[model samples]
Target: MTTLHLEHASHAHIHGPACGHTQVPHGDHVDYAHDGHLHREHGGHWDECEPDGHAPHEGHDHRHGEGCGHESVLHGDHVDYLHDGHRHAPHDGHWDDH
Candidate 1:
């Protein structure tokens, strides 16, 4: 089994999204907060995601460039995500981005 360690180059704990942006995967619920990739549990085990890019919750098969979720941390000023080994802005933040 692949032992995946969940971590980051830098870890900043934000109480909530700078803006009101939020992402709730189906049944999952979330409050405004720092955005971090989640570690999903599947069949009493952890999933080994592709080394090329990120993955969603277990049981869902998604590939790079194929409807990959544009999940981001409302960087307080804008919405951005890490993809292709770099951070990118997905949208221009406004007052009512919630």
Candidate 2:
């Protein structure tokens, strides 16, 4: 749970259900998908939301790699694959929801 102090959106840009961006639930907060990253409201600005820890996505068999047919999203130091409207990242030996 950290706020990207250097990266933020315009204070005038309010994000909501009709903001046109996808809303992603992150732990106790909600993040908005903008560009290729997730943003959350912090104070008067939008901070980049990078969730720590991984929640294993059970029943996942398909391995996501270089040509796995899923859209790759650069999440912090790792890459996450988008599958069925959710993001998946490789964990210890399985895929974790990012």
User: Can you write out model 2's per-residue Cα lDDT over 8-74, one digit (the tens) per residue?
Assistant: 7464678899998767766567777777677888777788776566568999999999998976766
Instruction: Note the residue pairs that clash in candidate 1.
Output: 16-32, 16-33, 17-33
Tens-digit per-residue lDDT, 1-98, candidate 1: 12344433333333233544343221232333334333233343333221233323333232323245755544455544444333343322211112
lDDT value, residue 84 of candidate 2: 75
Model 1 scores worst on lDDT over the 10 consecutive residues at 89-98
TM-score attained by model 2: 0.57
Please name the candidate that would achieve the greatest lDDT relative to the true structure: 2
Prediction 1 global C-alpha lDDT: 0.35
Residue pairs in collision within model 2? none
Scored by lDDT, model 2 comes in at 0.74
- For candidate 1, the clash count comes to 3
Q: What C-alpha RMSD separates each model from the true structure? A: 12.6, 4.5
Best by TM-score: 2
lDDT for residue 71 in candidate 1, whole number 0-100: 55
83: Cα error in model 2, Å: 1.0
